[model samples]
Structure formats: structure tokens, C-alpha cells
Target: MAFTLTFALIAALAGPSVAESRDELEKKKNGVNSEITGAQQSYDESSKAAGDAAAVLQASQAQLADAQANLGSVRGQLVAAQALDAQMQAALAQSEADLAQAEADLAVGEQNVEASTKEVISFSVESLQSGDPGLRAFNDLMNGANPTEFTERKAISDTIADVQLDRLDTLDATRVILDLNEQKVQALRDQVQVERDAAAANLANITVLEQQAAAQEASVAQLVQANSANKAAADAAVAEDAALISALEADRARLEAEIQAEIARTTPPPATGGGGGGGGGGGGNASGKLSYPLDSVRLTSPYGYRIHPISGVRRMHDGQDFGSPCGTPIKAAADGTVISQYYNSGYGNRVILNNGVINGVNIVTTYNHMSRFAVSPGARVSRGQVIGYVGTTGASTGCHLHFMVLVNGSHTNPANWLP
Candidate 1:
């Protein structure tokens, strides 16, 4: 009898030990599974980050290409300006040469006229002082010149005078031409100077472009480094996830072994039907009057501080946006009467629902961005009833239900209350 008692006591202690071991294994398995899930989430986030980095790198590369193109354009302009400067210089040189030739011709003409005048004066003195008649006549003939001779002499003198005059005239014309040429030369010089200045400016711009390109290259390098880091992080996360999954598999195997062992040890266990009966009690006194607007959908904005997306300025979002599609249905969150539903500047199409009391607190909901309103001012509404259709109208990006819950005119995040 003592032996039987000892055997029964040992069996009882061993049975509990087996059960405890199984339970511990199950717990470990669950912990491992959790770890695996966490690791997978981390891996996914890291992968997304790597993808974003790659996208940024691609954008940077495109920007670099554009910068290089602009640099090439600037260089082309500089080259064109230099070519224009060279052409202007050639024009100026030709103009100077023509001017010099004109001046030289004028000087030679003046010298020839002076020599002719002296020869005529010497001949005239010799004719008037001669002693012999024939000699005197000859001198007189030489000086006065007979009809034919004088005519010929006069013609020669006239020719000389005309030559001188023509030379003088040529000089004057040449001077005029020189003046024009000089003006042209000055103009060409000015043009060349302008071109040179433009080239210099372009060179400066090129330098700036080069610097900008260098900066962009540096930025690209930085992006590359960032991308590399992101990729490494992603790889690490993947490796960690793999390790966690392997660990979970091992833990599951251990749990199965323990559970099998527990089954083997337990035999002919007493069955208490299907466990304990689930107890339930009836009840009650649940009575409360819920007074709230049902289909009130009118409100332009909500009361709260919000940052402007583009400007990054912090301002109060006075109301909510509620306008939907042209004929979309709008609903009221609670039972309330519509206080006002009118078009305003900020609120294109608006509706305001005043919920009397929700959980012992007076509440008001505003809906904006509505296409049209089914109810009018002072209209009653019920909960979960369609009041209006959603429409994207007035200061709205798209059709969305802009629901707002206000407590005493103060705005709160609608996401917290809406189901």
C-alpha cells in the first residue's frame, strides 16, 4: 500500500513538471515569433529608405547633366563673341591703311605746286631785263608766250593749278574720309571692346558655372555616400531578419518536442466535459438620451493650429473642408440641427451641424468642401444619415470628407472621433 502511494505521488510530480516545460517552450516560441515580426518590419523600413536614397541620387544625376549642358552653352557664347571681336579688328586695320594713303597723296601734290610757281616767276624776270631784241623777244615770248605758245603755257599752268587744286581737293576729301574711317575704327574698337567685355563676362559666368558644377558634383558624392549607407543598413536589416526567422524556426521545433513529450507522459487524464462553463448574467438599467445632429454637414474650417504645407507657416485651421464631388453624399456624424449652411469666401460650400450633447458635452461638427447641401438652415438631422454629397469645391485639393469636431468652438483632430 505504501509503494502504491509513493508511485502515485511521483507520477503526480512528474506530470506537473512535464506540463511546466511545455508551457515554457510555448512561451519561448511566441517570443521568437515576435522577434521575427519586429525584424521584418525593420527590414521593410530600411528597404524603403534605400529606395528613397536611390531616387534622390537619380535626381541629382539629372541635375548635374543639366548643369553641364548650361556650361556648354555659356562656352559657345564666349566663343562666338571672340570670333566677332576678331572680325571687327580686321575691319579697323583696313580702314587705317586707306586713311594713311590719302594723307600721303596730299603731301606730294603740295610740293609739286610750289616748284611750278618758282619756275614761272624766274622766267618772268628774265624776259623784262633782256638787251638784244631777239633775245628780249625770245625772253618775252618765253614769258608772255605767243598766241599758240602762251596758250600752251597757260594751258600748262592751268593744268598745274588744276592738279594742285585737285590734290588739295583730294586732301580735303581724304581728310573727310580719314575722319569717317577713324570714326569707323573707333566704332570697331568700341565694338571689339564690347565683345571683349562680353567675353570676359561670359568667362566669369563660366567660372561661376564651373563652381556650381563642382558643388553639384560634391552633392552627388554626398548622395552617393548616403545611398551606400542606406544600402548597407538595408542589407544589415535583411540579415537580421533572416537570423530572427531561423531562430524562430528553431524555437518552434523545440516547442513541438516539448509538447510531444507532455502528451506522452499524460495518459488517461480525467475529462471535465469541455472545460468550465462560461458564466453569464443578465442585466439592466441602460438608459440615456443621446441628442446629436444626424445629417448636419456644414463647416468651412476647424479651430486648431496647422502648418501650411507649402509656406511652412503655422496658422489656425479655422474650419474643416467638406465639399465632395458634385453629387456625392454627405453625412452627419451625430444628431444635431444645422445652424448654418451658406457659401463663404474661405468656405466654398459649407454645412454646420450642432450636436446637442455627446457624453454630457456640447459638440459641434463642421463640414466643408461640399458640392451641394440637401438640408437648409435650421434643418434637423439624424445620426448616420446622409446630409450632403462630397465635392471638391473652393480651396480644396480633392474630394474628401473634411469632418471636424469642435468643443465650444475649439478644434480637435477629427480622426480621434470618426469611425
Candidate 2:
């Protein structure tokens, strides 16, 4: 959020060392304006930084969300891989059991074949040893017993050889079955290994995604913190600027009040006699003229619109300036009451004398840039009475007297009333 300070320049207060002169008032107002401008610049910079931080935080949050989603997806894949691995392990176990059974059966079949072969060998040896070449066997075969017993004995020897051959054939078939079982077990083990590798790869991906999410979240937090601080600084600068403007306005109000009070005090009393020394209206003659306030009068500046020396802006020169040395006695123009004695920035040491109304005009004469005051407020004096001494006390370049004539609280040409 952005805020601007919109305040008017304040008038100078009526205080000692305050802007008692127009030059000083202008300088003071400009100073405050410069401060306001500086603060506004600072606020703008801070606001921009906060805006940038907000953008960064938003992007970081989006990245974090993406990372978190990826992590979740990878974790799911890992779980599936792990489940597949478990199933493969179970199958491998079953295949291994079948392979073990086939091995045991083959071992038993070999033992049976060995024992049968041994029995046949023993019988053959006995038969060979008992006869000379073929004599005993032939005699037994020809005259041992009845034909049925001989035939049975010869069948037993033939059956023994056939049985041995069958046992060998059975052993070969069992070996083939065991080899096939071992192949099945090896395939299952390979499948389990593949599933385990897949699971490991999935787990690694999940870990990487988790780390990315954490880093993105941390970046988001830092952005948020910086944004908060920037916003605070902007707010503080704006508030301070507002406070300064308010103070300036208050000072202006106080000065206005003082000016109004001075005006009220200088309002002249009702007219009475035409002219008299020590009375309210002095310096009036058959010609009806007011006395000169200064003896050595050199008009340094005139009344009316002119460019200000310091401000360089055209403004009303409300008073007339007289070139005079410091400590030059400034006398009253007429018999009047000193209604106001105060200090002003534009008019350093000032005195406002109220000369009673003459020719239906309420005459108020102001003397400015005085080095010192010889009289106090409410003092009554005749024409030519010294009220103050001339000096460059207020917003002036050199010693001089600034004289003004106010008719009914408004300024008028002093030349019209001067003799």
C-alpha cells in the first residue's frame, strides 16, 4: 500500500528566533517540504522492495507445492516397488522350496539305483564263479529241477537287468525335473532383484524431492520475513511524515492566532478632537500631514508586487523600506497607542501603534527590523516620540526600517498617509 503526504506549507510562528522575516519563513517551509520529499522517496523504495519480496514469496510457495507433490508421487512409486518386491520374494521362496524337494528326490533315486546294481553284481559274480566257463550254469539250466523252476530263475536274472535300466532312466528324468526347478527358482530370484532395484531407485527420487521441497519452503520463509520488514519501514516513514506535516500545521495555526490578536489590539479608538500633542491624533496641521518616522529616509524598497529577493517569487511588498544605519531612532508618526510589541520572523523586533481614526480611516502603523524597543505595549506617545531604533534584526541584509500602514487590518500605501 502507498500513501502520500498532502499538507500545505505552514506560516511562521510569532516567537523569538522563529521565522520572523518573510525570508526566514520561506526557508523554513522549504526545509519541511524537503524532509517530506525525502521521506516519501524512502517509503516508495521500501514499498517496491516489499512488492518484490511478495512476488518472490509467491513463486517460492508455488515451487514448494510442486516439490511436495513430486515427493508424494515418488513416495507412492516407492511403495508400489516395495510391494512388488515383497511378492517376488514370496515367489522366489516357493520356487526355492520346489528346487530343494527335487534335489532330495534325485538323491534318494540315486541311492536306490546304487543298491539294486550292487545286488545284481553280487548275483552275477556268484553265477560266474560257480561254473567252469558255462558248464555249471548249463548243467543247472539243463538238469536242476522242473522246467518251470528253471524258467523262473532265468526270468529273475533278466528282470534284474531290466529293473536296473529302468532305475537309471528314472534317475535321468529326475535330474531333468531338478534342473527345470532350479531354472524357475533363478528366474524368481532375478525378478525379486529387479523389484528391489526399482524400489531403491524410487526411494532415492523421493528423498531428492523432499529435499527440494524443504529448500523451497525455506526460501519462501525468508522472503516473507524480508517483506514484513520492508512493509514496516514503509509504514514508519509514512507515519513520521504525517506527524511532521501535522506539527507544521499546528505551528501555522498558532502564528495566525498571534497575527489576529495583534490586529485586534491595533484597532483604533473612536475619533475625538482633530489634532493635539499627547492626544490620540498628533502630527496633524493645517496641511493635515503625518511626521516622518525616520530623519534620514532613503526609500530602499517600494510597495506593490515585486520579485522577492530570497524566494524569487512575485509577492506583495506590503511595507516600505528605509535605508538607515543601526541604532537610528525610529519615532512615532503620530500621537497613538502602542498596541502591540512582539517578535516575528519576517519582521524581527516589531511594534504596532494605533493612531486614532482620521478622515474616516483607522490607521495602524507597523515598525519592523528594529534593534531594540524603547516602549512597551499600551504605551501612549506623541508624534516624534522614539519607539525603537533601526537595525537589520529581521530577515534583512543591512540596518533599515520597514514601515507599513494598515487601514482596517488591510495594508495600504504608506505614501498616501505620509507627509
Candidate 3:
């Protein structure tokens, strides 16, 4: 009896050889995890840089378009100014011609006045030399040959005085017209100068707009180039990370295959009948009497149909989430063989256990978002054994246990199985 008890104690204390093989694999997995972490960090930094570059490119493109539009408007202004300048020049030329013609007409008027003065002086001298007008009139009346002849001589003298007065009036009118022409020419020149100044101002504005457009174009080109470079870097970083992850997964698969072989070679001795009755533990017993997977449970999410937080798609939620502090110890829900432990894209560090049949239905439970594993594949674990720790790994928002139960390969709500 003493020897038999000693053998039983030894068997209970030591783990199977298959478990030893799993330890080596877990160590390699940790190494691969470190590499994945490094790759993910690189990818995140590159993606942020790419996003910043894209923002700069967007702003630069908008500025470039505005500058181009402004340049077009400025060019139109310049064209309009040129047209106005040409019109002003033509007007100035016309004004100059008008002034020149007015001066020439004044010159002709002055010469005519001078000739009229000479004619009046010659007539005065001839008339004075010929006779004194009042004395001759009186003599002719006293010794008149006929009254009709005397009346005709008086009428001729009156016509001569009228013609001399008309010449003086014509000279006065010419001087007035010459003065008006000078004023008109000065006013037209002032108008031309104002138009010229406006044209110059518009041209200067157009030059500034052109320079701005050129500068904006250069900025846009630089930003676009930077954006392209950043995008390429981001793409390459993501691709490299994907390749590394693929290679690591392959390694994990091979290691798992070996673990499965080791389990086959070192299969445990079979039980003859039902092993145990209900026991006090943190997890379920062999009788399918379930226990809480943690010492204290706070439901973060419930199992049901719901919209996904990230993708916003309606899908079935196959698990229950329990909030926990980071690195909190997690227990197995029932007696089970460790089926697999690996990194999952959505589940992070995961461990799935086949907990044997319950009520004629195959019961499988999964623990996800673990920081690391405490057990290994192919190891037999009793209820309440430490299987892993809580973490925010693999598509998780925070530290939590995503606990799931499956029945015969189909997912079922974990809440239904939990007490």
C-alpha cells in the first residue's frame, strides 16, 4: 500500500514529456512576439508620417488652385488695362491734333487781323489826304450840284466805318477761341495721365499675383512628392510586417504539429470510469457544475447579436467579455487538455481548451486577449488552474477576458454556460 501511494504521488507531481516540448515552443513564440511588436511599431510610425504628408499635400493643392485662379484674373486685368491704355493713347493723340489745329487757326486769325489793320490805316490815310470828312460834307452841301449825289457820298462813308468795326470784333473772337483750346488740351492730358497711372497699378498687382502662383505651384509639387514618398514608406512597412507575421505563423504551425506528435507519443493512461464528484474551485467541475473563471467578474460586454465597434457591422458576438486589470490571473473553466495557444489577429494571445463532453454535447471553451500563457498545448489541466493573464492584445480595446464556449464545433453564448 505504501509503495502504491508513493507511485501515485510521483505521477501527480510531474508533468508529461509533451508539456516539456510545449515549453520550448512557448519560448520561441515569445521571441516571435517580440519581433511582431517591433514591426508593428515601425508600421504605426510610418503610417502617421504618411497621414501628415497627405494633409500637407491637400492644403498645398488647394492653395495652388487658388493661386492659379488669381493669376488668371490678374492676367485678365492686365489685358483690360492694356486695352484702356491703347484707347487713352489714341485719345491723347487726337487731343494733340486738335490743339495743333486750334493753334494754326489762331495764327491764321492773327494774320487776317494784321491785314485788316493795314487796310484800315491805308484807307484812313487816303481819306484824310483827300478831304476832311465833316468840312467836305458841309462844302458839298453849300455848293451842291445835286442833292441826290451828296446823299450817296454820306452813305459810302457810313459803310466804310461799319467794315472797320466788324474786323475788330473778328479779332476779339479769335483770341477767346485760342484760350479755350489751350484749356481743353490741358484737361485731356490730365485724363490721359490718370488712365496711365491706373494701368500701371494693375500691372504691378498682376506681377505680384504671378509670383504668388509660381510659389504656390512649387509648394504643391514639393508636398506631392513628400506625400508619395511617405505613402511608399507606409506601404512597404505594412508589407514587411505582413511577411514577417506570415513567416512567424508558419513557424508556429510547425511547432504545433510537433507538439501534436509529442502528445500522441506520450498519451496519458486512460481512466476507467468517471473521475470525480463536485469539488470546490474557482472553475467548473467534471459534473458540468460551472464556476466563475475569475475571482471577481465584471461584464464589459455580453454575448449577443450586436454592431461591431470598429467596423460598425452587425454580427453575432460569440463570447462574453469580462473586464480585468492587466496581468490578472485567469483560470480554466473546466478540466481540459490544452488544445492550442497562439497569437491570433483578432483575439491576440489565445488559448482554446477541449473540456470534454457535457450532457452528451462536446464542450469547448476559449480564452482570448491574454498577456501570456501559463500552460502549454497538450497539457491536461484541472479546473481553476492558472491558464493565462488578462491583456489588451490583438484587436482589443483594453485589458479583458474574451471567454467563449462552443458546442460541437458551433459557437454558443458563453453566458449560457456560465453560472
Candidate 4:
């Protein structure tokens, strides 16, 4: 019944949040939809570089999210405006129908009033010209000379008396009913006009809302465009990195065997009266210590399953991504020896550190996508020792470190192990 709708009402119709006048809201919504169509195409083509698109996508997502929010607010207003228009139109229709019925009843009542007046007029005219029939019947009954004649006259008088009162009552009732119907008809006409005016106003407001749907944007796309640099960097990193990605998928057993051997070595007995070489860290006993592989940890991606940005493949993401630029120092998480340092078309320059058992389990950590190695195999590095420099040499995008941790030689969540 309320004639006005506010931003809150629009939210109820569109969703549960946002605030703005209807026109501005509608315009932003249209802009949001268009922006998404364009952005999706860009994202798909950029993501084709072997999952590198995912790295830069985080960088580019802010603007697009804002656009969507603006659109959501506007979309709600349009629905609310349309709904109000419906209410106004329905009210106008009901008013018009009521007006028509009242007019029809008034017309019928007027005819009945006129007919009743004519019947009363006819009786008055007949009385003036031919005298009163009821009075004459009464006189005949009073002058009756025989008992049988008197009885017949009395019966005729009684009938005329009853008919006279009935005729007058009909005339009075008809006039009163006619007057009341006339008043109802006038009131209905006034209500119809009021509703008609309201409906017109509602329609005009809707037209304005529709026009505003073409609203312009000033700087919404700039945020998403800023991601180009990061996206390009990711592309170059993954160019031949599919080999590394495929190795992880198909050559898992071979890689694990080599790693297991390096971490299982015992310290050789002092080499026959010579300075001992670096001892291999065979992780088995608990030392109750672990640290972040990078000095600064900015987690970009967490350990879990995710759909490939472009391929839509469901796969487990086995490591945590730290936003470390290329050349950032990779450090040892615990006092342990290097498991291995190697390079291949599949795995870019990488190193694994065996941080001997902590919390009653053997812990091995790998730092991947490094620019170069800083430690030799079997080096007994202490906690926080530089092992390698972060790089995007492997199948990845952006300059970041892909750090992985294993418990008892099975890959586990790196976050669980890192400080």
C-alpha cells in the first residue's frame, strides 16, 4: 500500500545487501554484466599457460569483484521498481471495475425511482378526477340494507385499505435507495481517478530506471588490466614446465625412491683419522623444531584441492605458495642435511631438506622454482640457513616459492609444519 520504495526495498527484491538510488543502481548492474563477459574471455586465454593464469588471477580479481557488487545492487532496484509498477496497475484496474459497477447500479436505481414516482402520480390524478375508491367502498359498506350486502362491502373496504399502505411504502423505499446509490457512484469515480494518477507516476519512474541502465563507468576496468604483467610472467615460466607437472603425475615412484635414499643415510665413521665430510641428516628421531622456508611468508595459495582456472580439472594442490619474488632466500626449516639438489625439464632447479623427525615423525621439505642452489648435497645446514633462491623456473607463473612438506615421506600440508 506504500507508494514509495527506498534502497532497502530494492535490496529485498534483488538480494540482501547494497544501497543506492534506483537509477544509479540499475546502470551499475548493466556495467557489471558487460565487464564480466569481457573479463572471462581474458581470463580463459591467459590461464592456458599451464596453470600460471591462476597465479596472476589473484592479482586481477579485485576490480572484477567490485564490478559484480555494484551490479548486484543495481539489479535489485530494477526488480523492485517493476514490482511497484505491478501494484499500481492492479489498483487502478480494481478502482475502474468498482466505478463501472457503481454506475450501473445507480442507473438501475434511477429508473426504479422514476417508475415509483409515476405510479404515485397516477393514483393522485385518478383520485382528483374520479374521487377516492377506498372512501366510496367504505360508504357502500355503511349504507348496506341487508346483512349479505354489508358483508360483501366490508370485505372490499378491507382490501383497498391494505393495498393503499403497500403502494406508499414502495414509493418511499425506492427514492431512498436511489439517493444512496447515486452517492456511491460519485465516490467510486473519485477513487478511480486517484488510482489512475498513481499508476501513471509509477510507470514514469520505471521508464527512468530503464534509461539509467546504460550508465557509464570511469575506472572499473583499470584494476583488472593491471594484472597483465603478472600474467605474462607466469606464461614464460610454464612454457616448457608441463614436463615437471606431468612428472609429478606419472613418475612419482622414481622421484620418491631417490629422495628416500638420501634422507636414510647414517653418518660415516670418521674417515680413518681425517676431518669428517658433512653428515647426511637421516630424519627419524624427534627434535621438536621446524621453521618457514622463506624469511617472509605471504601465503597465496593454500594446500587443498582446486579446479584448474582454465582446464576446469579437479586436482589436489599439494603445496603452499608464498609470494616471494625471484632471488628471495630459501632457508632450512630445521638443523638437517640436504636430501638432494637437482634439475630436470619437469622440476626446475629445486632442493629438498630433511629436517630430522620433529613431533615423532620424519619431516622433509622441498623448495621448488628456485633460481639456483646455494647448498651442496649432504650439507649439515643449521636452521635458517640459505638453501636456494626463489624463482619461477618450473611450471608456474609469477616469482614465488612453491614450498612443500612431507611427514614420514608422504606429502602433507606445509602449513602444518611451517612457523
Best by lDDT: 3
**Model 2 spans with C-alpha error above 4 angstroms:** 1-23, 131-419
> Best candidate, TM-score-wise?
3
TM-scores for all candidates: the values are 0.38, 0.41, 0.44, 0.36
Clashing pairs in 4: 25-74, 234-397, 244-346
Worst 10 contiguous positions by lDDT, candidate 2: 1-10
Per residue, candidate 2 scores C-alpha lDDT tens digits across 367-405 of 899999898654556778899999887557788898987
Model 1 misplacement above 4 A: 1-153, 267-419
lDDT of each prediction vs. the true structure? Answer: 0.50, 0.59, 0.62, 0.59
TM-score of 4: 0.36
- Backbone clash tally for model 4? 3
| Tens-digit per-residue lDDT, 314-401, candidate 1 | 3345435443345667666666555556553333576766554445444566766677878764455666567776776654567655
lDDT of 4 by residue, 1-419 (tens): 01111221233224322221222223222222322232233234334543645555664776567765775666577679899889888888888888888888888888887887787788667768866555665676677656666667567656765766677898788778888888888888888888888778878877876655434122344555555644544554354344444443333344334333422332333223211111223442234546787878899988876653323333456678898879989987776655456664533677766555467665667778889989765455777789899888755667888777766546678777654
Which residue pairs show collisions in model 3? none
